[model samples]
Target: MIAAMLKVMVLGVCRDRGALAMAFVLPPLIFVVFAAIFSGTSGTEMRLKVAVVDEVRSDETTRLMDAIANEPSLRMHALANQSQQSLREAVAYGNADVGLIIAGALTQDGEQSPIVIVADAGRSMAGPILSGHVQRLIASQLPGVALRRLIPSVDMLSGGLTSQQRAQLISSTDEMNTADNSKSITVGESGAGLFRMEVLDGRGNVTVSYYAGAVAVMFLLFSAMQGAASLIEERSSGIMDRLAVGAAGTDVVVASKFLFLTLQGLLQVGLIFVIAWIVYDVALLPHLMPWLATTVFASAAAAGLALFMASACTSRQQANTISSFLVLVASAVGGSMVPRFMMPPWLQDIGWLTPNAWAIEAYQGALWRGENTWALLTFLWPLALVAVVSLLCAFALSRYRLRLG
Candidate 1:
């Protein structure tokens, strides 16, 4: 009996390609993606698109522009003839990462003018990136002056003039004569102050709100997969054929399964946010309506995807293997496991194809960005559409599979 069972087990393994792929192929692929996500930042280059409106038109202002242009990381976009307001708008709407305006003369009678740096709060890195360039330029020209004020979260930084604002004191010293070239760096505070959440990690900092959405979407896929696996179970137990004989037919069976999975997914996702709120202090209650709307659409999408996967596979093992592999791949590419921002431009574009990306984006908008109904719809609609399409495809595929069986 033992020898016969061993023979049967070996034969089963040989027949199931999905099991072989899951055991041997999928693990390495997942490992590769995880490795890339963790170490990829070291190889990734940080590039900032800088929008500039040079109203000063002075030699000193020209020097400042040149200094900015010389930074390897800064890509200067001179918006010649554009107004300062236009520069600010570009950054506000994300057309530009950082906005720079040089208004008035750079210096008059040894008094330096301020260079305003306009940046969006959502792009927190841009502010520091631009500021670092300015700091380097200042150090190169005005050696002894210190950064007077540094504010991280606030929208604006005032370059309030002090009696010793200029590097004139340094100019008095022959070893470091940069007093005359001292310039004040003022940040333009008019950009939209979008809500941002930061979570510290030993490895690095993460946007807590963004990851909250990502993690929710990731687990949602798993929940939907688990719920839809009932289809495979029913088929194995000869229940699917019996259900197909009912009044509403297999269509009702599929719809009921989809509905059940969707509700289950919603509950799973809700619990995720509850944990986020309790532990991470994420503000969800204030935007509960839109958050619920986003969750409904996201859950529907996951449910549809799960049904589609269930219909496409031949057996329980195959469905499990395929669904798990595809879900993990989608999560990795869709900013669930790794941020879309951290991905290469090509991969970022590819991420848009996944429902996970849209779901996460919707959650981010509703939960943290304070986007209203219409704005939330922009992301949610795509997910709803995907859910509809996937359900249709799953229905058709299930019919075909039933006929074959």
Candidate 2:
């Protein structure tokens, strides 16, 4: 009996093309996507976009900027004619991951540090990562500058250095700088005091807000897909035919399902965020209006996508397998499972196509970043359009199925 049942199960799965693909093909594909995304996150291969403002424009700062531009880990853009404010705006609006301002001479003594790193609060890691790169460059490419800065501290601590000692130190630094550029020399000291960090839109733990939005959209997609699976059951049981022939019609059936799924998704998002507020203190109430708008559009998009998937699938098993594959893949690529910044440039560009990306961005902007109405709309409109197009497609597919039946 065990052998017979095993054969029966295997035959059933083999006969279903969707199930076969889901069982055999989905795992490797998902593994590949995840590998490509996560393998570069260890700082060696991660490429960060850096916007630079050279206010001093001195020879030392110019050398520093050129070294940064040549770095493999950083994609540096020089804002030659732009101000530090422009660089800040670039980081704020996502034009660059982080901003650098060389406000003074590298070796100059002043009340403020010569370097400034501007970063967004949500992507808090970017600031530190860029800081590390800058420090590394200063130590390796600009050893003279590093040595000059160190001399002041040394003089302060030791009372003074003789002219001969200072001259010898300066000669060593110059020789190190003029040495083979390929080999990097380690400086025991850190460049922490050489730069100040300016974090933008920091409000009540932006990391918590990011995860709240990410989890909300991901579970919303899953819940909406599960709820929409009822269409497959109804069709299989002849209820779809009865409803199609009645005064209500199949259109009403699909529309009603879409509405219910949308409402279900909205409730799911609300509950998740309420917990986030209670436990994580994610600043939900302050931006309630835009939050609500983003929630509604996100829910509608999930519902429409779910309906379209359900309408196209012929069986519950197929729908389940396919929906799971798609939702997981989309969530991974969409910055829900991991921050998109951690992914390589190509994968990050692909994330923009997923609804999870837009929903997360909109929610983060509305709640954490305190973005204006216009900025919020840029993220919201894509979700609204997805809802409209998917709903129309699902409706047409359902009507076609009704005619065939």
1-405 in candidate 1: lDDT tens per residue?
A: 999999998877777787678777889998876666555433444446788777868655576677778866666766635797778666654456677766654332222335567765545566655766665664565333222211222114444434453343334432332346554443233111111112111111125666878888888898898788887787768787887777766677789999998898888888888878777777678778888999999999999999988888778778888888888888988889775645544555678998888987787667655666677888999999989999999899888877776
lDDT assessment of candidate 2:
0.86
Clashes of each: 1, 0
Candidate 1 worst ten-residue window by lDDT? 194-203
Error of 2 at 12 (Å): 3.5
**Top model number, lDDT:** 2
**TM-score of each model, in listed order:** 0.70, 0.92
- Assess the local accuracy of residue 146 in candidate 2 as a C-alpha lDDT between 0 and 100: 73
Q: Whole-model Cα lDDT per candidate?
A: 0.69, 0.86
Report per-prediction Cα RMSD to one decimal: 8.6, 2.3
| Candidate 1 TM-score versus the reference | 0.70
